[model samples]
Target: MSAIKDDAKIAVSVVVHACGRIDLLDRCLDALVRQQFHPRRYDIIVVDDEPNHNTLHLVAGWRTRTLDRGPRLSYVANPGPGGPPAALNRGWRVARAPIVAFTRDDVVPEPGWLAAGLAACDDRTEVVCGRVQTLIAPHPADAQPGAHALEAADFTSASCFLRKPVLERLGGFDERFDIRGSDADMYFRLLEHGIAIAQAPVALALHPVGPAPWGQSLLRVRHEEFDALLYKKHPALYRQKVEPSPAWDNYVVAGVLLLALVSALLGMDIMAALAFGAWLLLTARRCAHSLRGAAHTPSHVAEMVVTSALLPLLTVFWRLAGAVRYRVRFA
Candidate 1:
């Protein structure tokens, strides 16, 4: 890491959190390099969660290429505990500017993104939330088996700007909610502290939804563990903003299937048949809901059926696991 010169006059430090997706990172960097903001007033920092030769080389190449013409580009390796929050912390802590802008490697900002974000940051504003447009598959049939769009929330870290001093005062992000929910937690904390958050509608970024393999939704169930932590930390805000009620449908589905299994083991053939029929009905409903606007290919339909039948059980298990681990009365 080279030292930032004393007279560089950097105003905004754009922190991009990346994993090993060099292809996406390459596009993100390309967009940043062409920002409408003054090139010398802002710098780009790429924080790699899992830094390897490919990421290092990509950042190094961008740094060399943009050294004279554009904002200075640098790479930082995330220290310990891997997650977006940790990577963001690493990026801003080493930033040369007082204002920090956050975005992901998969997102491509418009040319005026930085300029608009900076414009919204007045003396009274401690944070600025930018707009993000998500691009998904052109057609349902072309969508991948487990494809999903990224959530373009009101105050996601993917397109927000924050004052470095305010971040330091708030202790940055809570690393315990490692997989997710940290961004909303931070936003709620800012409100608690009476810090002003402004919205910049003109600062736009494009997040392209990508393909995923089969069973991707099942793999995402682990994110529920952090929901317990978020709720424990901010019950009122979590209820108001996140979820007002538990997923009652998931519980119903799981309970019906369990009842069917127990009745069969007890040799109650009639009761087992009824419970199994109910379970099938509920599972079919879920599968139909999932396939509403999704790909309707035969394989996609099969995937939805199989995953929908098992998702309720998995979701309930993870929710309970989170509640137990966090010692919260969440469900």
Candidate 2:
């Protein structure tokens, strides 16, 4: 990677979407300040997405520590709590650079991360995505507790750089995505417009594993609605990249459990026993599969076990809800 020469121009705008988790956001800000790129060669824009958010104070605390003639750091509050896509678009709107890069508040980028991504950008490149390695926290209750190997990934906003023109032409991220899969949708649109999406393997970022509350995973069911939206917008590409499979497992589990409950109500003890036993077997298999590469503390194991059992049902319910909402016939 090439180091930024003295008197380099600020050509890159690194935008991070921040909500809560002041600690994580602070870490991300620290990493950005430490980037090898000359401070003047890049700027850091953090958009606070939380309603009545106080992240500006956090940014204020770090403001005085700005590098001597390094990248300019600023914070902006989102118009309202419209989610990541909104915060991203808001930041990019005010970005002064030709290249607009994005990462989450929880990510800690390597010193060379920006340089690697910048190197990948050229006249023909419209977007560049870097690699992200998951750093599992030692805590058992961490929501995303696991190790991640570096690998090629589809377009992800988690560690991505996009040309300013490309973003303007493509209309930025669709706010309908709300939170999840917004990057994929944007990249898909980019492909449709014949824009080039490049990969920068050397631009590495670390995603630390952290705990999520019990209902958080279940909330992802809303992605089904976005999935339906994606399919509606890009049928052929969606089919190629993410279609042809239904959540049959969810239906199976739901059906078996319903039958078991009905049988028990009717005094069909043998039938209920067999049905419940089958459900248990399926749940056990799911638990084992999920626990395979995860940190296996007692708390983690128990959390996985309970969530696994609920996942299929929740998944099916959400898919159906999404299908109804989007009228896409997803499942």
Candidate 3:
């Protein structure tokens, strides 16, 4: 732990949005505290969405232990509507520095991450997108079945920096994109506003893949709800940058499955059989495609098979739900 002069000016404020994952938050705080950047030049703020005894205790302990070690650390409980976007908004709003860096509680930044990100920022740069390296490995024995690794993009919420003025001007993240697509929405908005986004390849962070429960893929279909909202907000940008085309396979699967049920009710046995067969074939193909490069254990294979059968309906349902909720014509 290094000491900083009381009068030293802070240049960057790192904002980490956390939930109840105290373990991950602890590791993230440790990494931020050990940054190679000047202790007084940066500070760390953790915004807990679901504040609890454990989370408060962990942050309190860090504040006390780092009292004189520089790089001032603090905690803030998310005030209102619960979500990453809301928590992040609360964080940057209270940030003391002109530049605000965003990262997740699960991400462990490199020692030079802060310095690299700040170095890449210049007078014209409004945002800094950092490089994120995802650490993947086989699931442990005690890990839940069908667990998959997380992926990163060139511009993701996991690691990025933004100027406080730009954030305030843009009114921060849209709370409507509560689950997913909020980051992409914000990025697209930045582009629309002609805000400069500089890439900081040297500002690397390690995002370790964690375990997930069974049917996680199916559960994630709900993310499509937010995708529909994003599409409504930026149709052209969503098509160009987010998704060039819709998931035709999923549409086909959902359509045929619905047709099969309708045909059965009409007593058209032949049509019902044909539609059901098509659904099975499509689902099988999807399952095999999803298994590519994935774990081949019996439990994992079974999980994929079950999720593949249900994902089409679930995905379409959520997408439609979002479209209706957001008043969009997106399919």
Worst 10 residues of 2 by lDDT: 142-151
Clashing pairs in 1: none
**Model 1 deviation from the true structure expressed as Cα RMSD, one decimal place:** 2.4
Error of 1 at 254 (Å): 0.5
For model 1, the run of ten residues with the poorest summed lDDT: 141-150
Tell me the tens digit of each residue's lDDT in model 1 across 143-220.
343223234465888899999999999989888875358888898898889999999989999888776666677777
Better of 1 and 3 by lDDT: 1
Query: Which numbered prediction scores highest in lDDT against the true structure?
Result: 1
TM-score, predicted candidate 3 vs. hidden true structure: 0.93
lDDT of 2 at 277: 95
For candidate 2, write residues 1-331 as lDDT tens digits: 1234421466899999988879999999999988998777788989988834468878877776784655778888886647899999998998888899999898899999999999999888878989898776554442444224223347777799998888898888898786556876887898888888888989999887766675455665556667878877887888887666666887999889888999999999999999999999989998898777667877778877888888788877777777788788676
Superposition-based RMSD of candidate 2 using all C-alpha atoms, in angstroms: 4.3
Candidate numbers, best TM-score first, in rank order? 1, 3, 2
Model 3 Cα shift for residue 59 (angstroms): 0.7
The RMSD of every model to the true structure, in order and in angstroms, is 2.4, 4.3, 3.3
Any residue pairs clashing in model 3, and if so which?
A: none
Clashes of each: 0, 4, 0
Model 2 global lDDT (CA atoms, 0 to 1)? 0.80
Instruction: Order candidates by lDDT, high to low.
Output: 1, 3, 2
